[model samples]
Target: MAFWIFLPITLSAVSLIGCWTVYGLALRFNHICSLRNWEYSNSCLTNKTVTGGCCTEYNIPTISGSGTQFPENSLFSATINAASFLFVIFSIFHYAHILKKCTVHRFFSKSAMVFGCLAGVGAFVAGNCNPGELMFLHYLGSALSFVCICFYTVLLTFLTSTCILTGLERFLYPVRIVFSIVQVTLTILYCIFFTQKDFYYRHISAIFEWTLSMNLELFELSYAVEFYFFSSSMLSVLLSNRDEENTMILS
Candidate 1:
């Protein structure tokens, strides 16, 4: 049971480290343009940069942009798939934990699970559909993931504030609220800047995207505390067919 805490820990670690690794690899391969050179001309997009230079519009270094290359794309897809799978398990575990410990906030718990699972599915889709080729699907998946995660965190924060299921709720509630707010703020900024044609705004949006991802990873990391209290029995309860509507109704 104590080892369950590693689920969230690994999820956060894999997502954060793996994505940046892909970005670094993409840079090494010149698959994507640099993020630091603010003065880099848009001519880079027209093959005007030096020979063999990154001559693409992917100057943003977005997680999607960073993974548009060959080997890096493979790593990127694997990382997102792994992280998304863990997120689905995390959602299930959190819901089961709530059912095991609390009698109230069932609606919020169920809603959080829906959003969390949808977010995971979106991540999966985005991972498998590389943005360079499947731009529509990739952006669709990214949008779904972002939007669902925003709702998921807000609902989870609400549950944390109302229920003391986990002993860490007192601290976690405020912290989750802060994360939720920042996540929403960054999501909005990322969306706004993402639409601009100017490379500067696009680059800023990329920064927002990376920050949003790191913030989410940190949020997931906080749940390691809650997972520390998890038990295998909680999952058994969730899987049991016998339902007591009078007590806990998962449906």
Candidate 2:
């Protein structure tokens, strides 16, 4: 049970740090970027300049090309897709186990499972379809990924709120709800503004996109409490014995 949480948390941290590092480095080396800044740009015209570095933000998905080199670009995209797939897939199994233990109806678990898998597939599509190359497909994948992820988070938050599952705390429900709201709101705003032709709109949208990404990563980190409650070794299935389970059962 603990390792389930720890693994996802570690995955989120590594993915966030790795993507940020590569994007920042690539932005630094992009001499043709006009300025080394961090805001999103509708176009990468050499005249654009931001405060920190040269930023040619199209959509967040295009960030993989920030490195402006094959190694940097490919590495970032691959890292993102791989992490997204692995984390989501593992999460599906984790949730499935919880659902089984609780004897949750198939509908609730199926919704989460389907959306979770879709989110993973969306990530893979978005990561692979470079905005610079396949603009339409990239945006499509990004849209799907963001929307599905938002719903997925909300569903999981609801699941937590029910308090029917073991190894989760009651107090965490409201916190998860708040985070899910923020994530969904940002996703909506980003979709609206990210498509605008104006510079400020695009820049603001980029910030929204970044915020949403960081929010998801941070949300994943909150599982540290769950991680602390169990041991790492075979913890996923080594749930409490029947006697202990009887003691903890809510009803």
- Best by TM-score, which number? 1
Report the poorest 10 consecutive residues by lDDT, candidate 1: 47-56
lDDT of 1 by residue, 59-138 (tens): 55788988887889999999999999999999989999988888797889989999999999999999999887898999
In order, candidate lDDTs are 0.86, 0.65
Q: For residues 108-165, write the lDDT of model 2, one tens digit per residue.
A: 6558767878888887787888666787887788778888888888877877765355
TM-score of predicted model 2? 0.76
> Could you tell me the TM-score of candidate 1?
0.92
lDDT for model 1, on a 0 to 1 scale? 0.86
Using lDDT as the measure, the top candidate is 1
